[model samples]
Target chain A: MHELGIVFYIIRDVKAAAAENSVQRISAVVMNIGEVSTVVPEYLTDCWRWAADKEPLLKGSELKINMIPAVTQCQDCGQEYETVKYGKTCPHCGSGNTFLLKGNEVEIKEIEVPNN
Target chain B: MDKVRVIEIKKSVFAENEQDANALRQELKDRGVYLLNLMSAPGSGKTTTLIKTINLLKDKLRIAVMEADIDSDVDAVKIKEATGIQSIQLHTGGMCHLDAEMTRQGLDGLDLDGVDLVILENVGNLVCPAEFDTGAARNAMILSVPEGHDKPLKYPLMFSVCDVVVINKMDVAPYFDFDLEKCKEYIAMRNPNAKVIPICAKTGEGVEAFAQWLLEQVQTLKH
Candidate 1:
């Protein structure tokens, strides 16, 4: 649902960046999708295709998403691990007392474009 | 054709939005206002809670509201009619989450000079609104009893980011078999520090408690 809006912003930014760099066409857009984010990669790609095709520079550009798993740092044991299990307590320390460190991000990390 | 990089920007996607929200926080802080971003699913009694809170605390604290919705300002109009406090409606158009820039624009239309507390009723959703920080002093998420106990587990970020969790529609608990203890446990597991308060917005059962807590938060912000 919201992925469409986010994809629009990403395409706009990437296109602006490409134009600034004087790139004729963008090959691909790489994004880091946090596991915690509600965005589904499939939905994002679907929306990207629909939205990107409207722009000439992004007509054939591909949307590449790299999933980042949610990790947490345990306060008791000072350990970090990936946890897909909901209500994830630290496995090693068995502490429900852990803070999320990373993996909650949606960022365009890189854009591949042919140099004119 | 020569390729020239005008700006080699390595900026974040939400950097601009974050900046504006940060500015809003500072502005609210300077105004001695306790900004609270209230988030909840639709029909969670967010508006009812506000109506009760306004009745209890409006006389003591100067209050203002910025209401966010996808379509109508009906809620804002209702709040204004109920409380008669200055209110502004932020039409998100189609955005699920009310970001910093929208909030900043919302504040621009608000008069924060005489306000001691600012309440933002975020767009109704359990997922998207959790990501954007609206530069509020406190973020609250409301969960009504009818929405089921598994909401916190399904939408962990919303509960995790909230400083306070309001369990609204407590009067209907018996009918729905909503586990109060389990709900608290789920929220605690995700956010140990979040204060969980249960209230029946229709009966105004725990509105006093909420208003008191908000007053204390505002007082704390002053010093």
Candidate 2:
């Protein structure tokens, strides 16, 4: 699946950051997965476990996912509402002139390293 | 006695990919090539619609296509045989989707000297392709009648992010239980601004209108 490709990216970035900071062992990688993001958290972690374990620095490292709620903004009413609940229409104004404000991200929020 | 210290680094996982996508967008904008990322489920007439689109616009504008798949050059061959346009096949090596970096590499392989339009036929999958922005100026998705009308409801994110939604295989709309109006309503609910065009690539119906819309977009980019 594409999750493996994403896991590789995470590994590459984490390795680069670790080398720069002179950190030897990575303890966990935190991800900010939005509610609407296509990447399934379960599949991502499953792929991460398989790929991350192969790297010495990431062997036994944990993958933590932080779910972000999707929100939409109404251009007409200037109101913010849950994207999953209301979709493109703003519930308050009943206007179809709306756009997503957040919750489509698939980003690394933090990378944790063991300090000894 | 030893103490464990924790170092926290906040960064986006897609930062590198998004940066590459933005750079590629700027590069394409400078070159005046309007790249369109086309996505849909497998066997949804994506290639058929693309070929039809090429036939409509090949004479009006310089056009090329990059057919991406998990493997094989089947779709690429079809494009060349149908329109005689330059078609390149990108084997994703088992990946179901094309990211910005992959799209950049595919474009680099092509000779865009006089070409004003380049369409990236992304791998036939609804989920992953929608997640990654391939630096296309616009994103279009095709949904065949046989695929059913509830797809917009099932895959809300895909419908939500697209600029245009093409309902292909309209010629056979009578036989199937596909509701044209209902489908449009679903798409509108998810994406208010998305343009929905009902087309039958087999019969060339509604292809001209779609081509006109595409030309307008290309013209906008040119100016």
Provide the TM-score of chain B versus the true chain B for each model in turn: 0.93, 0.97
Interface RMSD of 1: 4.6
Best model number under DockQ? 2
List model 1 lDDT by residue over A14-95, tens digit each: 8778877777787778888889766889999999999899988888778888888888888899998876673368888798
Encode model 1's per-residue lDDT on B53-142: one tens digit a residue.
Answer: 998998899999999999888999999999999999999888788887778788889987878988999999988788778899899988
lDDT of 2 at A93: 91
> Which clashing pairs does model 2 show?
A107-B13, A108-B13, A115-B5
DockQ of each: 0.30, 0.53
The docking category that best describes candidate 2 is medium
Flag clash pairs in model 1.
none
Each model's lDDT comes to: 0.85, 0.90
Candidate 2, residues B56-163, lDDT tens digits: the string is 899999999999999989999999999999999999988888989999999989999999999999999888888788999999999999999999999987998899
